[model samples]
Target: MSTEIIYQTLAILLGFAGLIWSADRFVASSASIAKNLGMSTMTIGLTIVSLGTSAPEVLVALSASLSDSGSLAMGNALGSNVANIALVLAITAIVAPIPIAKQLFKMEAPFLVGVTALLGLFIFNGELSRLEGLILLLLIPVFLWLVSRTQTGVEQEEIERSEGFKTFAWFIVSLAILIGSANTLVWGAKGVALTLGVSELLIGLTIVAVGTSLPELAASVASALKGHHDIALGNIIGSNIFNIIAVASIPGVVGPLAIDPDILSRDYYVMAGLTALLVIACALTLKRRGSKLGRSFGVVMLSSFCAYYYFLV
Candidate 1:
């Protein structure tokens, strides 16, 4: 191993740690603020926490796209979806099978499918244009409106959120760390990829993708363990939605570029399939008296994820 490669490897490791911690800090502070502000768990999970967790991907997308590495951008946008489902959710389910929240099952779950379908349509031509990006951005508010309706019967809680000023201050600090760590991660990923004689897309698909996705993993797993099922399940669904519409839009707004053909034929389908699988899981589980994501399902997802990595290797 060369000296530069070693340094890059260290950077990636440090980058992952930084991104994950900052993401957790951001989500905790944001959730507390939302709860304190009179939002229900459902609303907090879907809107505040979800968007907070996906902040890394949004920034990384803008950074990569503006640097004229659209393929890298595409890889990060799509690859993270696969990681979120196959790795993050899978591991969470295996550790403690996540129960589908009732509100989430009805609204956010279906909305996730709709958003994914819309994103798929945009990239169908293997290119995302500025106009296309504008359309995606427009859909976010629409999605938020739909999400708002889902919390109709849910009652908001009023918490004092002690140390409100402190939480807000920490949130800002964490946000800064998230942005800087993401830049370091992407830079190290591209560097390591070049050293290994691989394309930036490949780097984004695996290393960069997983590194950026650490936030989702940490947030989801922590939520699941703490039995915040709404936030746990919603985080994955919301982040994936953000990944598609928000992350996908960055390249278009920054500088429209063609998506890789491999993504259309291979990567996009994998992402879509995993999403469909999740939708089906929710359907089958939600219909029962008490729904649960069993360890068996986790095994299936994890197996597929491992196979994907093996194939990539």
Candidate 2:
């Protein structure tokens, strides 16, 4: 490998590490600050924590948009959704079957499909306009509200409170690191894409997408192992919704983004198919009591993920 390629690869690796660490700290600091301000744990979770989990994708999209690589940003959004289901959720289910509450199937899962369909509509014209971006952004509050309603009367999570100055300092520092790391990852990804003669969209779809999705993978798998099936499935569904509405809007909001035809023709189909499969799996196993996505379904999901990657290459 060329020295330049090596440096770029290092940058990508380091960037991913920094992003994961800093994003975690940023969320912790934010939670601490919110708790200090007397915000309820559920409120902080539904809003700040939810957004925090997607911080890498949001920042990466922002950096890619500013650099005029909107296709990469779009790919990050779509590809992250694919990875969340086919890879992260798949692996989690393999570790432990994810149980689905009938309520989640009736509500959150359908909401994700709706959001995905909305994204498809916006990008169908071959571009995402600034107006469409604004529309997506405006829906965030609605999404949060809906999610808050679902969590009504749920147990409150215990949060740790830190000193005000320390919390603020960490928040600022982590935010700065998040931005810088996102830029570094974008630069490195673009460099690698150029070096390999591959499109930035593909790099975003594969490498950057998976890297940014590390948080979800970890959270979901850990939650599943601990028998928090709702959290595991909920994490994936929520992240995918956020990606469609929030992270995907960055490029369009920054400037009009011309989406590649392949996004709709190929990637979108893959994402949508997996999403439908998730709902179908739940419906097939749906019991009046609950639905379980068993090890068999997980194997199918993993196989589909491999097939999708093969198709991509």
Candidate 3:
């Protein structure tokens, strides 16, 4: 490759690494700080923790948006949802079948579908106005209210466990790194796309998108292996909701976003289909501790993801 491309390649690699680590630290510290300030476990779980896991995506979207890469911003939001479900959860299920938390099918899963449908309807007009962006942002509180009701039994231990190795100073440092690296990630992605004559949507869908999704892959697989099925599936469902509603709106909030009809026609459809599949899988195996997702389901999900990636490529 050319010298500039090599440098950009390094930036993307380092950016991914920094983002994963720093986002982890940021989440931990932020949660710990809130806990120290006497915030209730359910409140922290529903708000800060959800925002923490999704921090990389929101930051990436903001970075891409401010950099005038609106397509990248939109692509990252849609692409991350696709990866979170089809790829991340698929691999998690393959490693260990994720059990169905009865509550998952009852609330969060359906809420996610509703939010995804809302996103679909917004883009149906072939554009998302600033007014639409504000509407999406306003819906976050409604989501939080829904989460609070469902998470009424959210345990203190779950919140503590999610916060790993908390460090207040390191949180600030990592927060800075996360912001800086997000810009780096976006710049490198745009550079590589330009050099290869690839569209920003393609670059965002393939490389940049997957890189940001690394956090979900790590968290979900770890949760599944540990038998914390709620955290495992909940992480994917919650993050996808956050990505669709919050992260996707940043481009328009920052500036005018040109709607890509391909998103409505293709990528978002892949997201919607996988989401419906998740709901069906949960409904079929509704037992709380049952293997709603076994190796067979894993194979199917993974196959679907592979086909999606193939289509993208």
Report the number of the highest-TM-score candidate: 1
Question: How many clashing pairs per prediction, in order?
Answer: 0, 0, 0
**Minimal lDDT window, size 10, model 1:** 153-162
Ranking by lDDT: 1, 2, 3
TM-score of 2: 0.79
Query: How does each model score on lDDT?
Result: 0.79, 0.77, 0.74
Better of 1 and 2 by TM-score: 1
Greater lDDT among 2 and 3 belongs to: 2
Q: Over 4 Å off in model 2, which ranges?
A: 11-49, 155-190, 288-291
Q: What is the TM-score of each candidate against the true structure?
A: 0.90, 0.79, 0.81
Model 3 vs. true fold: TM = 0.81
Model 3 C-alpha lDDT per residue in residues 100-149, reported as the tens digit of each score:
65656556777888888988888888887788787888888888888777
Which of 2 and 3 is ahead in TM-score?
A: 3
Error of 2 at 28 (Å): 10
- The Cα error of candidate 1 at residue 129, in Å, is 2.3
